[model samples]
Target: MSNRSRANRPTPDLSDANNPHAQKAQNFGPSAKRLFGILGQDKNTLIVVFIFSVLSVGLTVLGPWLLGKATNVVFEGFLSKQFPEGTTKDLVIAQLQAQGDTNQASMLENMNLVPGSGIDFDRLASILLLVLGAYLLGSIFSLIQARILNRIVQDAMNRLRIQVEEKIHRLPLSYFDSIKRGDLLSRVTNDVDNIGQSLQQTLSQAITSLLTVIGVLVMMFIISPLLALVALVSIPITIAITVVVAKRSQKLFTDQWKQTGVLNARVEETYSGHAVVKVFGHQKDVQEAFDEENDSVYKASFGAQFVSGIIMPSMMFVGNLSYVAIAVVGGLQVASGSLSIGAVQSFIQYSRQFTQPLSQLGSMANLLQSGVASAERVFELLDEKEQDPDPLTPATVAHSANRLEFKDVSFGYTEDNTLISNLNLEVRSGSTIAIVGPTGAGKTTLVNLIMRFYDINEGSLTLGNTADSAIDVRTMTRADLRSRTGMVLQDTWLFAGTIRENILYGRPDATEEDMVAAARAAYVDRFVHALPDGYDTVLDDEAVNLSVGERQLITIARAFLANPRLLILDEATSSVDTRTELLIQRAMSKLRQDRTAFVIAHRLSTIRDANLILMMEHGEIVEHGNHRELMEKQGAYWTLYNSQFQAPAQHESQTDGDHI
Candidate 1:
């Protein structure tokens, strides 16, 4: 047995079929069918590649036959050297037959020889040149085939990424409620990239390998049927080995990818809240969780690779055994005068070509399976139910749609659990309504409903200047509804950008003068002027470079610049210091004039001047009136106001007198 057998040559067709980074998959049966259906978009291109691959394989198979002709020229020359000039092979065979030497006479008859003929150097040279041309042409076809396959895979992957991105925007809020952001991100990124790479590595080479098998088998049968049958002994055994290994490796790879997503989610959570982990002394717990998930990924990866790694050496061993059988059977045919030396040489080569593709095919099962699994994850994201579509004919607005009424509105994240039920409320234009409530009281949810972030399960939420002009929020497109409203949340969200850029995000087309006015109104100009870069200073991730109050001011400035008729302030002053809070209050007072505003507050001090005050509990408005009237009622609003402010105000008042 040759040490460098052609059956296991590593000449780089796409890639070496040894170990791949992405693991094999378990669901190739159903998932693989859908996966290929997507890749079939470029049917014409695939057909062109198929034709090229067949031509390449056909040329490659012809090389061995031409070389066998050269072997005949050399063997016949060696036979001619054994006899005198002018003696023919028929004369020698008749003399041997008269002398009763039947064995020698039979061998001489099979020999393709004439007495006194030396080596036909001219024919040998011609056959060698033809073999070289065949090999060269096959290589050119192979290269062209590989380039086309590369384009097909890259274009297919690009479409998949776009599909994933568009699907994200169309998904309902409820779909996000129960899913992990990090896991979904992993599918969009890691899984999609793995599938692209697998296809790139397997496609061109797989087609070529299969065609080579068919072409080589045809040549082998033409040369000798008995030897061709002997060469095929390894097929059944190799298949059994693959099936056995496949069964064990499939689940191992599946667990590996699943664990990878879990690990990524763990890393995202811990990193996003690293400061919280340190403050609460939970560093050890975070590290422990990370280690657990990391270990799970490691174990799964190890088992998958170890089980699949056995395929190569096992297949090579089977091939070597087949090689031994072919040689033995072929030698018997030559000695019995049924075959010649050159024919046996050519049949051995055909056997090698046939078995190599089969071995290659066995290795490709890993990549093919891996692609199907990754495709399944991405397909899941694409197939999730989308949010309800926008209206076909949206409601028109003659004026600002500021006044909002939630009449008999009911909503729940899920159908079985209702968070807000049969809530009815109406607000006049140019009025500021302050909603005060304890935790889980639908304070934020009510504002979200106005913005149409979540559609109500029952009843209509309408908006307009008057009752007669009122339009159902569902009748308007989300863009038309949201464009007329602005929101400032307690949790400040500032991406990595300059102060000016962040302020202009809510109103991208606003003039520089308008942005500056909004900044000054929000008290953002007070600190921004002190910085060396002024409004040009760049913020890092999460805008960590700015102070808490400064970040809040920028968001307020963004909302101010929008100039929407309906403004939602959800604990907007919670992050600011006392003096900054006072300034924001004055700015908010000016912004609320001639506009409708919804203010959800935990601190009663900020909303004392609101036109209408509402106290909500368990999604119900228990008490509502102007501030002075609610204070006189001595009900839920009065009790909550006292509990939150009376004692703290008393202490501050007592200290203020002594300091003065």
Candidate 2:
């Protein structure tokens, strides 16, 4: 495809304003369903949690009921004089019996007999003990339930992180090109973290709160149906308010996350190119751009949080109103003698208990929304199609050969702009082919095709000793193809590890002796021996400790250790000094022996010894001949060589043999 066309391709929209859910339901793609599915996978744990949660609520109700009972006993014995001396023991027993029976005769028996003051103290102490026990059990089990739920959440999070990482590695390169690096990083790090936090803090709490609410309502209804109904009336109103607020904040949070990514990208870009910025005196301009993005992120985050913040207070307001209504109604019932003081107190306590969970649910709404937003981003990445599918039954090659051929191959990144069309090429075993081309002339693209980095859109690429029984490049596994192809690019990438580690990266199982031999051949051993730690010397990001020439030599050493049949050198020595270039040329000379090599170089002087040179222009071979034949033709190669060779001595001195 034309570079202009690719550069102008429409970017995908990630803005919250474009999403329908921003205006209505707070749903984030299929994340809601997928999250529920993940939670449902641990049904046993959830079920156990539900049971424990119910037990906890049951204990909570029992605590307040026991407290109310004890209060009534003390009041009757002390204030009302209902249980005076001598009859107090009987009164206590009768009270307990009445509580179990709930009949008018049992209560009358207690009122008529109880008169012992010491007995009243003993009964009150027993009731207090029961309440204490319920509280103790409730506290202990609540901790246990929380611990168990946390483990479940952590396990699920671990699984999710692994899945997301695997998906990231499997995704096509095109997908990466389409999305911002910072956004992907946010999805993996920030979004996944949000999901985990939500699970830990909000999801489990919401479930437990729900169980508590239901259990409280059941207890309240059992005590007084009228009071339970009054409490229930406020629930829907609280939920409606919470839902409306949550819906408003969901999109806002999504936008906040996206803005964070933009801000992160800006920071990453600036930090990575700090040297360039300083050289160009654009630090202020960069800072201004950063400030703009930072402001957007701050506004979005504050707005989302503000909307979410209103939910808890709104719920608390409704809960307080419900408490007042229940209090007034229950007091009237008690005063009219239809309800006991103990029963009215129990109903009021239960009403608060019911509202507590609803209050918690309201508070958890923000977390829920954030989790949904994060999940949507994560799932979107996971859902992207992979570049290559693993072969169901892979084909195997019995033997290795150096011959490579591209016959009538027509290919392009896009349909309208063809990079290579009707191109035919064949390389004999153990021969060097140098490809010379201007920028945008498909030089690197041709090498990319040969390595099967991309498959041809039309025609076949074959590799074998002969064309008759040639093996199609697509039929062979990518790993197998890559293993047999050695590549050295202009930019050398060294990971943060020991020098030996980087050298052996191409063949992890290579022996120390084999590594040293390859390093010696690539002229890397010369520099390594001078280092403080020899092969054990550690490298940092971009190997900033090493010069450009040294890094390139190390990369060459890695490729040398790979020892593949096909070698591709893409402007490999472009950034090195003249003396270092000579060393690299010597290494390349040894490396190219008996190998089918495709060398791309701008400096015509370096490839003079190549068996054949193909000069390319506008994705087509404009001239093809040996070095002398191209010079004799006085074509594109002649013009290029003359232009470069006629440059000032200083400019020529600055050039590394193969670099433009």
Mind giving the per-residue lDDT tens digits that candidate 2 earns over 1-660?
223223423344445556322222335546688876777778899788877777776787687778878767765665335445554555566665667754443444433234544237788899999988898898878877888888888888888899998897677555655666666788789888999898788876787788777777777887789988899999789979987898789889878877887777678768877999999999999989989989999998999899998998898899999999999999877655566677788888888888888889888878888788778777767777787775767665634667888889987766787888888888887889999978778887888788766678898888876666677778888877778899988868889999999999989999999999999987888888898999999999778889888998898999999999889998888878888788778878888888889998888888999998999887788888899999999988999988887776657677865485
Candidate 2 accuracy as lDDT:
0.79
As a TM-score, model 2 comes out at 0.89
Deviation of model 2 at 217, angstroms: 0.3
Clashes of each: 0, 9
Off by over 4 Å in 1: 1-26, 94-111, 529-536, 647-660
Q: Pick the candidate with the highest lDDT.
A: 1
Candidate 1 lDDT over 1-660, as tens digits, reads 111111211221111234222223236677777777777999999999999899899999999888888888898888877888898888888888899988667767877777888888988899999999999999999899899989998998998899888999888765655456666778889889988988888888789888988898888889899998898778899999989987787777666676777688788878888999999999999999899889998998898778877776788889889988999999888877778878889988888887788778778777666666677777777777898999888886755768888899987766776777888889999999999988777777787688877899999998888888998989998889888998998888888889999999989999999999999999999999898799999998678778988998999999999998999998889999998899889889899999999998888988999999889887788988998999898999888889887788989999999999
